[model samples]
Target: MKLKICLGLLMLTLGGCSSLGVEPWQKQHFAREDMALNHEKLDLSLDDHIYFSKEGSSGGRAFAGGGCGCN
Candidate 1:
């Protein structure tokens, strides 16, 4: 029936998500500097500071500073 087909499809879709992330052995490759989200750490930090100063919110990647732009 249509209900059974829908249930099977839903189960199939949900099951596919289990394989969607980095495996244990793949962590080393993903942790490499070349694989970093932002290749330039200094530029990324400057951008983060600008974002925090504009949005009045902070706290990410161990950065500790206020939004007053005092540095």
Candidate 2:
């Protein structure tokens, strides 16, 4: 029936997702500098400082105010 076919297809799709991540031995390769989110660390830090100063808030701090510029 169509229900059985859909269930089998769903199961197959879900099963395929289990092999999607990096293995233990592959972690070292992924941790290299070339795989970093911000290749220019200084530039990224400067940008963050500028944003925080312009918004007048230090993000993720233990303060009592919102820092996302929505207020």
Rate residue 8 of model 2 by lDDT: 98
Give stretches of model 1 more than 4 Å off. 1-28, 36-39, 67-71
- Against the reference, the lDDT scores of all candidates come to 0.78, 0.69
Backbone clash numbers for all candidates listed: 0, 0
Query: All candidates' TM-scores?
Result: 0.40, 0.36
Residue by residue across 1-71, what tens digits does model 2's lDDT show? 99999999999988998868887987997789977876777876666666666676464522334344543
State model 1's lDDT.
0.78
Write down the lDDT that model 2 would get. 0.69
**Best candidate according to lDDT:** 1
Per-residue alpha-carbon lDDT of candidate 1 for residues 1-71, written as tens digits (9 for 90 to 100): 99999999999998998868877887998879888877887887888777776676666774667646454
Clashes by residue pair, model 2: none
For model 1 the local lDDT of residue 25 reads 86
